[model samples]
Each structure stands twice: as C-alpha cells, then as structure tokens.
Target: MNQNVLIIGATSGIAEAVARHFAEQGARLFLVARNSEKLQAISADLVARGALEVATFVMNANETDRIPQMTDAAWKVHGTIDVALVAHGTLPDQQRTETNIAYAIAEFRTNAESVIACLAALAQRMEPQGKGVLAVIGSVAGDRGRPGNYLYGAAKAALDTYASGLRARLFKSGVHVLIIKPGFVATAMTVDLNLPARLTATPDRVACDIQLAIAKRRDVLYTPWFWYWIMLIIRWIPAAIFKRMKL
Candidate 1:
C-alpha cells in the first residue's frame, strides 16, 4: 500500500490496470508512456481512484537513448521506487515482419532492444537502493520459438534471459527482479486475434497476479497460473515433432 511505483508504458492495458491497483492500495505513482493524452487520462483516473500521488512522463518506447533520462526523472519524483514495471512492447504481424528485414528489425527494437536499454539504466539506481522489485513483462511466447510469432518470441526470449541473469545479480543486492509471462491477455495489442475465451485473461486479473508476485519477491510469474504447466509441456516436446505441428 505504501509502495512508490514507477511504470514504463504506463498507459498499456496491463500497466494501466496495475496503476489502478496501486492507486487503490494508496501508492504514489510515476507513469511513463508514449501517449501524453492517454497518460494524462489514466493519471487523472488513478488520482481520483485514490492514488497518493500521480506523475507522468511521455516517451515512445523506441527511444532507447532517452531511457536514462526517464529513469533519472522517475527516481527524482519517487525517491526510491518499490516496484518498476517495464511493460511496453508491440505484437507485430508475423508475415509482414518476416518478409521485410527493416520492419523485422524495427519490431525487434520495439519489443527487445528498448527493454534491454531500460534494464541497463534502471539497474544502476535499484542496485544502490538495495531494495524493491524490477518487474518486467515478458510473455509465454518466449518459452520457445514457434512458427506463428517467432519474431515476437525471440524478443521476449531475450528479455527472459536478461531478466533471469539480472535476478541473480540483484538478489545479493536485496532487489528482486520479477519476470511476468502472460499468455493470451485481452489487451488492445491482442484485440483482433481470435483468442480462446477459456485461456484468455483480463488485465485486472493479471495486475492482481503481478502485484502479488512482487510482494512475495517471486523470480517469475506465469499469469493465469496454468501457463506454467502449459509452457512446461510445450517446452518438453521434442523438436522433431514440435517443428511439424502448427501452434
């Protein structure tokens, strides 16, 4: 309830839900997102919903060079963030991304490089504080590469690798790094997809899971809970048969 939270991609479906949860818990928030108008709307809503304080920064997630500045400003306002959520990413069209090398690289930059940049910048501050949670939003797609969205999967895989190592590195420093892997979330990003109702989860449900994971200082979270077993099964399938099957 007393957490000072800093969320990058704050206006995102999951991030916004997390912010509202934080607000309900009486936490002060520093939100960063590319959309100023959307950010303002969410911030105002959070304030009205009982956020102890609300601050914002407008930044396109692709602008990796400005990440340090964003971190600096967030820490300036919040002093020490109890939780920092990196939640910005895009789910690009697999066919289009696969065909266009330049487009593929751009999508990769958005989903992977920018996140790596944030991890580098945020760690310097969190390490010194010797406390808090560095929570990154990864995906179930990262567990393994599939024909459907391998490009997006690769980006998430990179994030998982980076976070896995960083979790160990920061463990001794008293800062917990949490990696959240959500599967088929009902967000704007996945709105057009033909997601199965039985498997899909709402942003609010994910937000609850994330905060709970952070509180417990868990290393990783497979939201909706069942993704853990689902991914486990998928990861175990022999590559020979796995490659032939459609995901």
Candidate 2:
C-alpha cells in the first residue's frame, strides 16, 4: 500500500530532512510551512527525487483557525494521511526573551501552543482511522532545564508531556504516537551556537533515526541513542548544583 505523510514545517532543516527520507520511501507527501515559495520548491524537489506524490500548504501554524481548512485540503489530495510529522518550531534568542515579555510569549506560542493545537486537530482525525502515526520532533533540552535556554526548554517540556499523554490516550486505538528528543541537532536552529561535534547530530542522521523509530513503533526516542543515557544522568542531578552549572 502507498503511504501518505504530512510534514509540518517542511521548508528547512530537520523537517526538510524528514520529508526527503519519507520521499525516498515513496511516500506521498503533504508539506506545510509559512513560505509558499519554499514549499513549492520543496514539493518540486521531492517529486523529482522519486516521491509518489507531493503537495504543499502555505499557512502559519500559529494561525490555529486555519488548521482544519489546511488539513482538509491535504486529506482531499492524499485521501488519508498515514503519518503526521509535527516538526514546526522556532528558536528565539534566550537572552532577548528574558527582558522582552512579548518575545517570550511569541516563543511559547510558536513552540508550544501552535504545535498542540495542530496536533490535536490531526489526532482527532487520525484516531478514528485507527491506522496512523503521529510523530513530533522535540528536544533533549526539555529533559532538564539549563540556565542558557530555560524558556525554550520549558516549551519543549510541555510538548513532551503532551505527547506522552497523547500516546497513552491513543494506544488502544492502534494509532502510534512518537516523541523524538534530539540532542543538539546541527540545523538552522542551532547554527549560531557552539556545540561539541561528538555530541551534535545532523538533520539527515536525525531523520534516519526517526524513520527507524516509526517503523519499530517506539514510544519515545533520543536521536543518537546515547543522549538517552546522557539525559538520564542530567535529569538526576540536584537542582542546587544543576542551576549553577552552565549546561
């Protein structure tokens, strides 16, 4: 059977990588992002690269009311979405968010609320189908809040909790819910940050891991796997010492 995959935030970075991976698998794609030009370019590229089918939706995820309309259009094109990859995200400067309440609010809305609303809409449709996978790209930063990017971490933490609950709720329905926690992915999101090469992951690597996890029906995955152990240790650290250290 041909698979239909819907990927949010497909214009750049990890989402784009995920799209390429699924396209290579001959999955029909419905790519979503705010930029129409980029989405069209991606759609064309995917079709040229041997995708079964390709479509694009230009809508800001922050505009929650437009979600149903956009989703319905995708459903019409692809018939039924077999996989929904919720990978839309924004990473604002942490220091700026500290002083600007508006910036912090925007970050929360972009990273947390928008994802929740869109995923909830998708889940409602997919639950009744009883044969779909809902995969979200989260961050290892959510595992333990560090002094550097606590705001982003907090938003990701909320998403992690939501995905966990969604997984439990949808288990009996045969709809798989996966939460991907990638540690320090080298993408546009982390281009400015100095990170250790040993610990950092590329988007292609992360995308491959995501495909494997979905195929295995894994509930939660830490990209590179070693981050799972690393986060486990970090999660156990005492707040007194953790707060002082710059992680």
Candidate 3:
C-alpha cells in the first residue's frame, strides 16, 4: 500500500535516509527543510528511486508561527499523512551555550521549542483522522545531563518529556507518538565529536531502526537497541558519582 509521509527537517542525514527507505516502499513524500537547494535535490532523488510522489517545502522550523501553516500544506498534498518525522536539531558548543544566554536560547528554540511546534501542528491534523505515526529524534544524552553537552542534553530531555505526554494524550485518538533516542549517530551532527565507531551508527542504520519502531508503534525507542541498557545504567548512577565522572 502507498502511504503519505511528511518529513520535517528533511535535509538532515537521518531524514534523507528515512526518505529513501520509504521511497523504496512506495510512499508519497512531503519533505520540508530550511535549505531549498537540498530539499529539491532530495525530492528529485526520491522520485528517481520509486517514490509514489514527492513534494518539497522550504522553511525555517524555528519560526513557530510558520509551522502550522507549513504542516497543513504538506498534509494537504496527499489528503492525509500516514507518517510524520521531526528530525531537525543542532549540536551546540557546550561552553558557548553555558556562557551565552542568547546562544542557549537559540539552541533551545531549535532543539525543543521548534520540535514541539511541529508536533502540535501534526497532532491537530492526525488526531482528527484517528490514525498516524508521529516520530521525533531525541538522543540518549537526554536521559542524563553530562557536563560535556548538558545544554544540548537538556533540550533533548525536554523533548523526551513532551513526547511522552503527547503520546499519552494521543493514545485515545489512535495516533502513535514515537520518541527515538539515538546514542551516537555518525551524521554531520556528530562529525567533530570523537565517538567510538562500535557505538556509533550510520544514518541508514538508524533510519531502519526508526522505520521498524514506527511500524511497531513503539512508545520510546533506543536505536541500535543496546543504548537502552546503556542509558539504564547511566540513569541509575548516583548523582555525586555521575557529576564527578568525565562523560
């Protein structure tokens, strides 16, 4: 069956991989991104790879006022959206954010506020239809605040909490909300960070995990699976020890 899928932040590595995965499965795609050039390229690529239809939109997601309008337009393309993925975020410099309130707020707006705005718009549409999958990419870092990137971690943590509450609210409406917690994904987001190869997954690999989670209607997902236990251990550590340890 051909399904209508909307991908916000569609130009990101994981989102692009997800688009290709869905295209192979014969989905109609509505892709949104801040970069018009990248959005057009992705749309063209999906069309060539066998997507049923591909629509592209360019907008900065941080402009909360624009989200509802953009989301509605995207959904209008296929009449209904079977799946929507919110995959945009930033990895801010920890020291910069710590000292600069402006930088901190900017990162927060991108990582958390913008995501919530998009989700709220999608939920308004999906809840009425009684069925749809809303998935967002968070991170394992959200589970705990490490000194390394606590600002980014806090933003993701906020997203995780919001998604949890949203999932419960949408349950009665039959809309499934999925929160994806990825440990170390080797996308451009993590290009400069020194993460272990064994622990880091490629965007394609994480994309496959996301597809599976959506299909299963999983509430919260740790991509690569083992991150579930890793987070469990981290979350259980005593605060004193956790604070002192170099993450």
Candidate 4:
C-alpha cells in the first residue's frame, strides 16, 4: 500500500530525517511546520526524491483551535493519513527556565500541550479509519526527573503519560500508537549541549528506529536500544543517592 504520512514539524532535525526516510519509501507526505520557506523546500525535495505526493501546512502546532481545520485540509490532500508523526518540540535552557517563567511555560506548551492537541485531532480521525499509526518523538529525560533539566523532563513526562494512555485507549481501535524515547540526539536541539558520542544518536539512526517500531506495532521504544537498559538502571537507583549524583 502507498502510505500517506503526516509529519508535524518537518523542516529540521529528526523530523526532516524521518520525512526523507518515508519519501524514499514512496510514501505520500503532508509536512506541517511554522516556516513556510523550509516547508516548501522540504516538500519540493521529497517530491524530487520519489515521494508519491507532498503537501505542506504552515501553522503553529500550539494553536489548539487551528489543529482540526489544518488536519482536515491535510487529510483532503492525502485522502487518508496512514501515519501521523508528532515531532514538534523545544528544549529550553534549564537555568533560564528558573528565572523566566514565561520561557518555561512556552517550552511546556510547545513540547507537551501542542503535541497533545495535534495528536488528539489526528487520533479522532484515525480511529474511524481503523488502520493508522501515531508516532510521537519524546525524550528519555522523562524517565526520571534530574535536576539538570527537570522542567523539560517534567513536560516530557506528561507527554509520555498521555501517549501511553492513548495507546491503551486505541488498542481495540486498530490504530497503532508509538512513543519514541531518544536519549541524546545529535540535532540542532542538542547543538550546544556537550554530549558524549556514545550516548548520542544521529537523526538517521532515530528515523530508522521509528520506522521499525511503527512496522512492529511497538507501543514504546528507546532509540539505540542501549538506553532501554540504561534507563532501567536509572529507574532503580535510590532517590536519596541518585539525587546527589549528576547525570
């Protein structure tokens, strides 16, 4: 079957990588993002690279009121959405969030609420179809709240829980729900962070993992696989001693 994939936040980083992956597989695409220029460029590139079809929607995912209208228009273009990937997120500075409540709130809305709104809209549409996949790009930070990036972690934790519940709710609906937890990705989001190569994964690697997870109907996956064991250990650590140690 010719897959119709909708990628929210398709302009850069892991989302762009996933877009290219699906385009190479001859899937029709609906690329949604805030940047018109980037979206057009990506759409053009995908069409040139063997995408069955490519469409773009320029809108802020945080605009809850606009989600249904935007999704309806995209569905009209593609006919059916076989897969919807909610990949829009923000990683704000930990220190800045302490001094700036506005920044923290913005990050929370962008990383959690916006994705929730968009996914909810897509889920409603996919439920009736009885055959679709909803893949969300979450982070391993949500596994346990560390002091370094607890604000971001907290927001992701909320998202993680939401996705898990959505998966359970959609179990009998025939719509697959996948929650992707990437440890440290070498994307523009982590450009300034000093991360070790072993702990970080590339965009292409993450994209491949996403495809595999969707194909296997996995409910949750940790990119690179090693993170699964690592998080397991982290989750078992004693709170008193774990709180004192830096991650």
TM-score of each: 0.98, 0.97, 0.98, 0.97
Q: Considering every candidate listed, which one attains the maximal lDDT?
A: 1
lDDT of 3 by residue, 1-247 (tens): 8989999999888899999999999999999999999888888899999998999888899988988789778867789999999999999999999899999999988999999899999999999999999999899989999999999999999999999999999999999999999889888888999999899899999999999999999999998999999999999999988988999
Stretches of model 2 off by over 4 angstroms after superposition? none
| Candidate 2 per-residue lDDT over residues 67-139, each given as its tens digit | 9998899889988889999999988799999999999999999999999998899999899989899999889
Over 168-241, each residue of candidate 1 has an lDDT whose tens digit, in order, gives 99889999999999999999999999999999999999999998998899999999999999999999999999
Give the lowest summed-lDDT range of ten residues in model 1.
Answer: 60-69
In model 4, where do residues sit more than 4 Å from their true spots?
A: none
Off by over 4 Å in 1: none
- To one decimal, what is the Cα RMSD in angstroms of model 4 from the true structure? 0.9
Q: Write the per-residue lDDT of candidate 4 for residues 99-169, one digit (tens) a residue.
A: 99999999888888998998899999999889899999888899999889999899889889999999989
Q: What do the candidate models score in CA lDDT, each in turn?
A: 0.93, 0.90, 0.92, 0.90
Better of 1 and 4 by TM-score: 1
In candidate 4, where is summed lDDT lowest over 10 consecutive residues?
A: 11-20
TM-score of 1: 0.98
